[model samples]
Target: MALHFSRDEFASRLELVKARMKEEKLDALLIFAQESMYWLTGYDTFGYCFFQCLVVKADGQMVLMTRSADLRQARHTSIIEDIRIWVDRTNADPAQDLKNLLMDLDLLGSKIGVEYDTHGLTGLNARRLDHQLTSFGTSTDASYIISKLRLVKSAAEIEYAEKAAALSDDALDAALRLAKPGANEADILAAMQGAIFAGGGDYPSNEFIIGSGADALLCRYKAGRRNLDAVDQLTLEWAGVYAHYHAPMMRTVIVGTPNDRQKELYAASRDAIEAIETVLITGNTFGTVFDTHARIMDERGLAKHRLNACGYSVGARFSPSWMEHQMFHAGNPEPILPGMTLFVHMIIMDSETGTAMTLGQTYLITDGPVKSLSRHSLDLISV
Candidate 1:
């Protein structure tokens, strides 16, 4: 089936944000950047360029602020009711222009919060924004506010993500079917990507690396002129967005019967992933999961090569980002509440052997148990 999401799903998420805003003592949440804008509004007019900003206040009023040129398309597509369009000047900074529009809309001094993301705001842009905010006396900084709201999963979002993971599994199915001793890694990539479009999926956030043999030395590495060998181990690390949510994961593939050494390591990784999956129930601290995996690897003396965590974030988008959750994650200890979903991938890269291994799965946090959404088998496959 073609992949898509219901508009009600996004609407429900916005309401979730509204509830978060009330708890956070926020009047409205100001949104910039592409991902959050799409997550809240359901309109994705390629916000990668040009002016696209939004203000969602608590009065059930969500206003989208954009330039005059973008207003027509935005109103035609955005879920927001109020469309505030600003006229562009011949020679002016868009940031300053946005500030002026905010002041005109009386949003100044409204405890507005901005997302600086990983990088701190710079001096020039900060000075310009400060000068503009001073004109109307508004307060602003990186609140890490939107993140907490984004952590918990909404029902409709899980539904779409579940489907997205299935679509990705199908993509890998097609890729593995095409894998052969004579084919290059790119050969299977083309086949996998073709299946993605055939199933109505869009582009992956990062490149999908499907290399084998020498190419597998570096983790998150790429496929080169190196050809797949019948005896060589294969790795497939890929995740893409469906309806703007992240469905990140990976899988291991072998072209034919595996040798003794390869088979042993593969069994260890596969078993380790299974052990983690079995215990990934709701309310368990993520550290508990990591410590357990670390112990398993410690028993094998493979702890140093094991990653920090067994899983990471899965949402309406596949991020090319560094994970920094304040709770229930590494460096931060908080309970794993129900309504959060994540994709767990265990990767082992051996540069000396020119080999790599991966075992991945996706799960949703529920009151009773963690429901596994990825139905793909976790065994060594002979393609």
Candidate 2:
């Protein structure tokens, strides 16, 4: 099997997950989160856009219910041997298949925990499963049971994250080299993604957030692309993924001469990140860290240019977003801890001046201070 971790490690992860299941009084867990599946057994596949689930019994027995397309995928990538395939006929109901599987295991009447928030389980399918299981047993929303267990990184996980971070630095360097006057934004993005893949990295959970000129002020990825202006800022946010672990980086490059206002914004953005770093150590509240960023930007008179949240937890994630559930924002009382990966971005987009300046990097939280994952300098780049 192509399991990413050793058998012992996978076994330990299962033990942790099952322990959490017991704590929640969950007789069984219906894991629909792809990340949770991969973490438990190295079941890697993009087939999660369809219906699939990994059922873990309280006794620690696990089974994967998926489509035929992912049959070989499960065999090769994961240690899951007892795989069940659900047919794709128009009238076929996989929920019924799941119910049968539960009955076969003599768990049909037991309380089960379902991952209601994952993309792997659609609303229609969830309702169907809930309706069917209502007669058999109770299914509770227990997404956080497995998710919270994954917040802290193991040693092997951190190693993969470190490699991803270095490759992300390489990607940023390649993209920066291509950020010249009259350069195509598409080419820059290609260079960035290509660098990561060339370095033995996997595709990130989401598309790169890249834009130039007026579009640079935006944060999320969009449909159209543009060329770098001779005197404009090119904003980029990309990640290097390895073994599904992500190390994301963000920076804004000036194609030509930067105005005084742009430079001032960049300085404040850098200072804001530095201030946040001071409070990102272990034992600090995540909100405290965000407050540092907010205070820096607000005190610098750039509050209007800031984003609502400063950063979030990062880990092995699949598309839609690389952001983990734990976020650093106002009123979020989540505490920072060692072995956590976080990405903090000092995003400042001044719509009034039509300029953008953003600086971001990922870090591994240690006992004392956090270690920078991205190798690139946090200073604003000009080319």
Candidate 1 residues 3-88, lDDT tens each? 13456776677778777777766665666545566666665555435555676776646777776776666666556668776566
Best by TM-score: 2
- Score each candidate by Cα lDDT: 0.65, 0.89
Per-prediction TM-score, please?
0.85, 0.97
Q: List clashing residue pairs in candidate 2.
A: none
Q: Which parts of model 1 have CA positions greater than 4 angstroms off? A: 1-12, 49-51, 58-60, 67-73, 84-91, 118-131, 134-143, 221-225, 318-329
State the displacement of the C-alpha of residue 190, model 2, in Å, after optimal TM-score superposition.
1.1
In model 2, the number of clashes is 0
Show pairs that collide, candidate 1. Answer: 109-138, 153-339, 244-316, 244-317, 245-315, 245-316, 245-317, 246-315, 246-317, 328-334
The clash count of every prediction, one per candidate, is 10, 0
lDDT of 2 by residue, 4-108 (tens): 899999999999988888888999999998999999999999999888889999999999999999999999999998999999998898899999999988996
Model 1 lDDT, residue 245, Cα? 60
In model 1, the Cα lDDT at residue 152 comes to: 76
lDDT of 2 at 217: 91
Q: How many backbone clashes does candidate 1 have?
A: 10
